[model samples]
Target: MIKLCLQRSLRPAVLLSRSALDPAVTVRKVPIVPHIHSCQMGTRGRNEPREPLNSPKSAKDFIYSLHPKERTCLLMELQSFESIAIAQETLQPTPPTRAQIKYVLFHNSIPFVGFGFLDNAIMIAAGTQIEMSIGITFGISTMAAAALGNLVSDLAGLGLAGYVEALASRLGMQGPDLTPKQADMWQTRVSSHMGKAIGVTIGCILGMFPLFFLSDDDEEEKKKRKAALTAPNA
Candidate 1:
């Protein structure tokens, strides 16, 4: 009689045979098919084509070709110094500071003050009540005009910022993986100049407010005194 036992997992099978005359059992080992894991087969099937050294797809790929420790150190160095390198390469002018904005406002106000006084003198000399009202209306209208100017300037600034941010992203100065502090720094640089320009414009508009009341009141006073004197005589 013969009996066979198979084992799981690439192990050898055992065969048992008995001879009727000798009453002794003989055992033999037989080889079985090797076991293969499904995961290993899938991994082999999913192998991607390697990028060539001569034509690397990206900086990351070029870095990845280095030894593990060397790659890690190089990446760390790049992360630390990337911003400095980009800033050195930049050709754009620096954004205006708050102090510079104040200076600009002061300079702009000088001209605006001269113009406001001239306008008031002209309206008052015209001597029509309607001309005085027109001067006041013009002063008030400047506030609205300043607001519109600020809006347009802000929109233009935002458009320019967006274009710069896109370029920075491409150049690796700004990227999707940037930390919070980095993003804030980038936003500050982009917005500070526009804010300064808007502030100066508003300052000039506010400086014009006193012009609205600059017309001479002496004429009205003289007219009132003349009316009183003539009333008693009449």
Candidate 2:
């Protein structure tokens, strides 16, 4: 039918008009299909929704949303974008297990254990030494001595952080393998916070070992303060 139409259309204009005018011969209208030799008859598909052209926000979205046949219009080199390694986000990540959370808890707590102990112990020891040596001569307040001692402890922490981490690593208590989503879970975060809090509390309690070796000045001051508070003011 197409061949016949093409043959007749190729004829002289006089005969083509007569054939159209005569009712005896019928001229069939050629229906246009959606896709013909990779060329679409219309810009939008018949069944496809007429979405806004500005729907795509970026080049990637526009390209990814392009129909396979539509991609034929692109340059050969540009067409190779399909080969680019993009992140494949398919399956949902598994939630962290109890053991995994425990691992994270211990992994974080272990290193901080030494840190807390050292920070508290060093501060106490340093403060006491400062009071005995330079504080008496300079008439430095106990609060000032404590503040300077804390500074020394912080500086020491800054230096010894790597060593503490290194020592903790030798314990063979590595964190569990989990996705970012799993690691960010409330349970994991809670476990981490709890572990650090508990470790530091214990470390601070242990760090009070220095108090047993110190003079009874603090006790005497506490008694004096209590007596003064209880006594009537003039």
Which number leads on TM-score?
Answer: 2
Which ranges in model 2 have alpha carbons more than 4 Å from their true place?
1-88, 217-234
Total colliding residue pairs, candidate 1 = 0
lDDT tens digits by residue: candidate 1, 1-119: 00011112112111111221234745455433333211111121222344544432443455444554544444333333343433334354454555544444443333333333333
Those runs of model 1 whose alpha carbons end farther than 4 Å from true positions after fitting are: 1-93, 128-234
How well does candidate 2 score on lDDT at residue 97? Answer: 90
In order of appearance, the predictions have TM-scores of: 0.21, 0.53
lDDT of 2 by residue, 13-44 (tens): 32334444566755545432243233221233
RMSD of each: 28.6, 24.3
* Model 2 root mean square deviation, Cα atoms: 24.3
